[model samples]
Target: MLQISLFRRIVIFAILIGGLVLALPNAFYTRVEQSNDARAVIESGLSNDDLSAVAGQWPDFLPSGLVNLGLDLRGGAHLLVEVQVEDVYAGRLDALWPEVRDVLAAERDTVGFVTREESGTDELRVRISEAEGAARALELVRGLARPVVTVTGAGASDIAVSADGPVLTVTLSEAERVATDNRTMQQALEIIRRRIDEAGTREPTIQRQGADRILVQVPGVGSAQEVKDLIGTTAQLTFNPVITRTTDPATNVAPDEILAPSLDEEGVFFVLERAPVVSGEELVDAQPSFDQNGRPAVSFRFNPSGARAFGDYTAENIGAPFAIVLDGEVISAPTIQSHIPGGSGIITGRFTAEESTNLAVLLRAGALPAGLTFLEERTIGPELGQDSIDKGKLAAAVGLALVIVFMGLSYGLFGWFANLALILNLCMIFGVLSLLGATLTLPGIAGIVLTVGMAVDANVLVFERIREELKTAKGPARAIELGYSRALSAIIDANITTLITASILYAVGSGPVRGFAITLGLGIVTSVFTAIFVTRLFIVLWFERRRPRTIEV
Candidate 1:
């Protein structure tokens, strides 16, 4: 006979009620989203009476999570970016010069002086003055090389150093190049995500595409150009000691220094040391603020290690000028009057409030290791997304109505129970999605539509088995039990196979494909629960209360 313990019944009802409660927020999505946003702002230490009012719109007792609509469903900008990994090669070689020079200079009695010569874009060449000391110079440079730690890079040096006649050639090794490429891609993805997140845009998809490419999709961001503008900036902030201030372009500066034009003043140039005392990567915080002159500026604080480095540099180089370089332009060149032990300072430039705010955002996001070159870009309009959403809703409603009518006419009272369970299954799908903060895309809607049809298939199988059991001279209770028990294996088998397919899709695909897989997988789980447990519980309760002696098929 069909029977359910009070505890089992209560647990099933509790799950259904919990799912309904979680799914409730989506009905008032805009207000709940606003409340969530306001709550986040208040939690971030901002004081605003209006935020309190907004946050109170959603009840505190209710779950505030809502399903995130994807780029296709909400409209956005899409971009395919290829990171220029090779650009880091020249920089790596340029940075290696100081170490190479210092090492070679120690053995000056034997190797003599060395001078850098023009070479390939990816190579570093140093011409030793004495040809007899070339072997010693090469050995000294090779000592600077370290083993690459990565799996594929095992036993390989970070750089390849060789003696070519009187000159020594240096280039990044194959192993180090692979490691550098991986690091560059990861750093680029993180910086881009940070920059977009700081802008307060919702649910941006920033992911790696293959080896060197990044795929970026920002929902509600209208134009690809806008997103490009936000992440394209290589905001490399560094404080370099001023080698000299020169008006003449031909002023001979050391090879270790670079001449950068002043941002505030025209035609003025500050020749600064190529090695930075502190880089923006070391910055812990940055915000827009006013300088002592009441001009718009950005205030920044460094991490502990950077604080010590900056403090030491300032203490030793008192009275010397240090150039603050942003990108390729010198923002300011100020004389160090005293030691600045606290590594917090303001960047003074001729910037408007908006410019200062944007600069602060970039600085806070940190610098990208390599620049991105946009390979492809497109903007999806909100109108198209709305149309898709409208059509998807219509398709789902029509499908649901047709299925309900067919099931009701075919199976009578039992059909009504299956239809009710089907409706709850959809609620559970969205509820679980919201709970998990899953994104819903256009393909995801299609998955839901597919699920609506498949959900009834298990019920149909069970109903047919019951009809067959009735002809075998079994009573209604015995027939129902046999139907459900025998159909359970087929139901589990079919849904499990489909769930495996969705899992594979989620694993291998990106963006909309993953969204589809997510909804399909969740739908399968919810449908199985409602079919085997929820629908059965409803039938058992009815039969127990009524205690029917006979039933029509």
Candidate 2:
């Protein structure tokens, strides 16, 4: 009575063949990886003869997806960086100064002449010439305060205003500071992720650690310094109104002015306004292109708001030099020959093509909200990863061999069927991983080894049950049917419990732990299918062909 229908048999064989086909690329990982890379280049419209040759290493008809290797397996850069959230406070205060100046200037009759006063990094202070109108100055500044947007900060004003004599002090409220900190962290994480993705790295782990720390692990990068060079630069680009050109590094400037060294000329400096006409945040697109002289340069376009502001500034300040600043340094100070209306401009400097391309990428990714201080950095070598891979292979092979030998010795011919199912179960695991584009770590390899033993456990349970049923004087066919039917509940119960544990691990854990959980959970599913269905199908075929009347357990 134990039999598989023709339809069921076809389904089983189809799954086996499909899994094997999907998993075939992993057998030629290096060749397939090169082919994939070359294909990507070709698709990006930058293909060459060498790239075409490399892409042809693998057939076009086969699946090219691969199981991505984790940082532990592929070697990469690891960094722990602390975001300087306080830096954003200073920038916010700087931006608030122009609005405060304009507001107080509107009430010049009551508040008198207003000038920005030097204060703490987190506070903005405005001094009025008339001490009697202190209350009026404070009231005007407080009017600029907006309600914080965060739930916890609801009803709280973003800026707290107070008066001391003729000086009006403005600082971010406690709740607003907390809200800003959260926003800064989120923005920093997003910018870092974009920068790494723009660089075309695979399987990067970019996540927040504590309050201000970010952990970055980029697989396949050359070194930690290389990664630092990629993401560390704030790339804060701005166009500020140039006050005057100077050769002195220690030139005195007003509170609203900044003295920045020119990037092209060593000793030449430019004194510029602290507030910019348009910042990098308003940029909509940036690309690497050649300037009029055919030199490497970066071209950029602005959003609607940015275009309006840039157009107004250029129109009003024709014949005056406008400083293009990047992270506090004046990269270029070019004279505005005419009004540029379209909000499109080119930045030309002493740059190689590669540098210009990298600048374009950073510009497109947007600027980081805050500065990053590298707390720790490490570069893992591929040699170490290769060693780990070699050891992991040895352990998995040894465990698999031992399990196969034990099953073959214990249960005779039925054991051979179980061993074959175990092999297919592993192939299915790889197939699923490849299909999902999962990363494989050292711990993930251990999960696969553990699965090799677990894969045959259901077979062991069913074989032992058959031996017991045979002792009860049942016929071979009846005993085989009862054995599988009786063991089904136990097999399902055991695998279900393990799968729950794996799910929990995956939900709460990160990096290596998640890798292990993924492999373990996937292994449990494939193991149950192979043991209960594939092995049973094989036994059913053998029995149907032989029609044996009696059998040895």
Candidate 3:
């Protein structure tokens, strides 16, 4: 009666063998990781002979994926950054000036001359020459408003325009502010991720903390300050038309122009138009290259719209100078020698090779939505990570040893069968993790150790049930059948309850707590599978071979 079908037996063995095969690559993690990195480099068109050769070291068809280690297991930097969202509001108002001017200019006869007023940085104000025309100007500016894209803001305008005497005040509506803040936060998250990825660091945790904050964690990074520097640089590259060259930095300039000092020349300043002919957002590609004079430079190509704008501006401006500005600083001001119609151009600023490469990386990653203020930063050293890993391994070994010894002593032969299943269960956990590429943290090691003990609990329950059935005058085969049958409900119920708890922990927790929940949840599944099916198969095979009349559980 304790017989397993050929299909069932094959499935159980196949699972055990498949798990071992998949988990084998992790034992040689360094080699596998090297192969993976080499493949990435070759695929990215890096043209490294050594890397390309190493890419084939691991077979293409093998399970080469390894479990990623968390920040605690591997040394890394953690950062809490607060995005300055309000800074965007000031820039937004500045950008809206041109649109407002164009709209009001359409009805200049009715409103008379309109002048922009210097109000609070948070608001945009324009004064009408005729006080009686305030209503008409307000209506024209209000006509520029668009409907808000939020559920709570139905029928509300994007901007609130009010007429206070002759001056019309404009502020971003509550709905628009919410939308802008959300976009800023999401853009910040994506840009941070791209920057870290560009730096070649592995498995960074970039997430939004709140409405105005981001959390960044990078494994194998040298210091937290390095990550902060990489993320905090706005890298807002723009090409603005040169208004004039000036020596006075504080010269009174029009509102549409800004004065920025030259990077290479002393006491030299360039007044540049505020509006950019081409912004970094339109840049599709950027790379480090050498100029005609053999100086390091950055070559960039823009998207279609940007290419058209840049081409038209360059064709018209001919010999006029244009400034390449980055983060409000003038990097270079060069005269347009010819029309650059291909949308590609070089930026030469006496850059070193490393500087050019770094700039290119920053450009390719795109600009941050808002400047980041580092709220908290810390570095976890490799020594600390190694110590944690050693302690975790020791704990797991001790836990596994104790569980195996206890099961061997209590259940005799059946206990040894459970012990074998437990060993296979450990391999299956790692196999699943490697397959999923889940991150393993220090707390995750604790989950595995906890699982080692709980794995035998089902076996204990079944053995106890068998003893009870024997006392009820049941034969050896009947007792074994009844034991497995009746103990099924308790095993399913207990595992399901633990799984639910792990799910809640994973959903609510962040970082290491989530790692713990992941391993705990995975361990529960593997433990249940091994206990209910694998150990039963082993017991069934033994009984089938020996044909025992009376057996001791």
Each candidate's root-mean-square deviation in Å? Answer: 1.7, 1.6, 2.1
Q: Please, what are the lDDT tens digits per residue for candidate 3 over residues 507-528?
A: 9998888888999999999999
**Per-residue alpha-carbon lDDT of model 2 for 1-553, expressed as tens digits?**
7888899999999999888888999999999999998998899889789999999999999998788998998999999999999999999999999999999999899999999877888999889999998888888888999999999999999999988899888999999999999999999999999999998898799989989999999989889999999999999999999999999999999888899999999999999999999999999999999999999999999999999999999999899999999998988999999999889999999999999999999999999999999999999999988998999999999999999999999998899999999999999999999999999999999999999989999999999999999988889999999999999999999999999999999999988999999999999999999989999999999899998988765
For each candidate, give its TM-score against the true structure: 0.96, 0.96, 0.94
Q: Count the backbone clashes (under 3 Å) in each candidate.
A: 0, 0, 0
Please give the CA lDDT of all the candidate structures.
0.91, 0.94, 0.89
Better of 1 and 3 by lDDT: 1
Clashes of 2: 0
Model 1 Cα RMSD, 1 decimal: 1.7
| Candidate 1 lDDT trough over 10 residues, lowest sum | 248-257
Q: lDDT at 217 for candidate 1?
A: 94
| Residue pairs in candidate 3 whose N, alpha carbon or C atoms collide under 3 angstroms | none
